[model samples]
Target: MGICSIKQMTTRKLLVLSTIHQISVLLLSDALTVSETSPDAPNSDDTTSINHPRNLATEALYINQNFRRMVLKRNEEPFKYDNPRLPFDEGDTDADSCVAYKYRSWYLGRQADGTEVRLICRTEHDGVTTGPNGETQMLTIKAFNEWDSRMASGVDWRSKLDTQKGAVLATELQNNSCKLAKWTLQALLAGSDQIKF
Candidate 1:
């Protein structure tokens, strides 16, 4: 984001990005909104407080236990959750709304048509979604919290960023080169058709 937003985006890149955005937006999402006004809901006026880390985690658990549902196929089903509880995992289960685990395969192949094909991908994404009509698509949600700053540790971005736009951009190549490359690979491997950022 910092790199892409810092300088001019090519017309071809913009076209491709906007096209993907349009298509992903049209995907059938039975997505749950924080629509109801219950006793436990966050205050409407203090919007920023609602995005707090604690609130987000609580909200995820609330959704995953009952409302969260995703597509799961392939034999990777058996290895859903880890045998031992991971520090970042909560084994939330119980009810028919029990969210199923989806298995992502990383054993990607197909490099050549000569005799044999070989491709090695060390990382894989687990965000695949299947529509009601059996159209498989990967849905990725990319956020922009980092782009609001010049670097990972800088503050006062609102005031300083405007004056140092050129300097900030100059650092993009030095700091974000690998990050940009990784995002490109992720878009290609994880969501070929439904890539969005």
Candidate 2:
């Protein structure tokens, strides 16, 4: 019986060792190479630097208010900006009520040298805002890893807003991953004192 008990103890020791080995292997393989927020990702401060083009904002407001078909230009030349214009109408309500708005195409992408490049962008709202008591409704965005390197090199992101808006998102698409794009815009929008209606 003593010998049998000794054998059992040996087996238990082997089992525990195997378990530890397996866990260690898993941890080593699963070790994250990138930082928690992606090395290339834009942080909150990055978003504050982006502001909707004044012309684009005015166009959106005009469209939303006038209901006329007009092509919005980026006004910032070479930045090919074209997006669906919308506006906020408080009607007879106080001018302060004019906080409602919507984003038409705020993200875009492109391809270069077999790798994709993405652009972080967004349009503005002309209507009343919903979040804080007072805040500006602005478009927010971030570049995709696929296109991030190129975009960070100083290219105006909002070059095209209408039909080519998809290009902005497409240029930066890395195997169809949307996490970076979403995070970028969300971070940019986080600064608002109030959310748009």
Backbone clashes in each candidate structure, one number apiece? 0, 36
Per-residue lDDT over 1-197 for candidate 1, one digit per residue giving the tens place of the 0 to 100 score: 35554235686687899999877555312222221222233233444665443344345444433322333344554233343233335565532223223334554455566454445443333345567888756553322122323223333446656898666544443444543455567666654444333
Candidate 2 lDDT tens digits, 53-110: 2322233334333431122222433221243223344364444312223343434455
Q: How well does candidate 2 score on lDDT at residue 13?
A: 95
Candidate 2 displacement at residue 35 in angstroms: 12
Instruction: Predict model 2's lDDT versus the native.
Output: 0.38
TM-score of each: 0.27, 0.18
After superposing candidate 1 on the true structure, give the runs of residues whose Cα lies further than 4 Å from its correct spot. Answer: 1-137, 143-156, 160-174, 194-197
Which 10-residue span in candidate 2 carries the lowest summed lDDT? 30-39
* Model 1 TM-score, all chains together: 0.27
RMSD to truth, every model: 21.7, 21.1
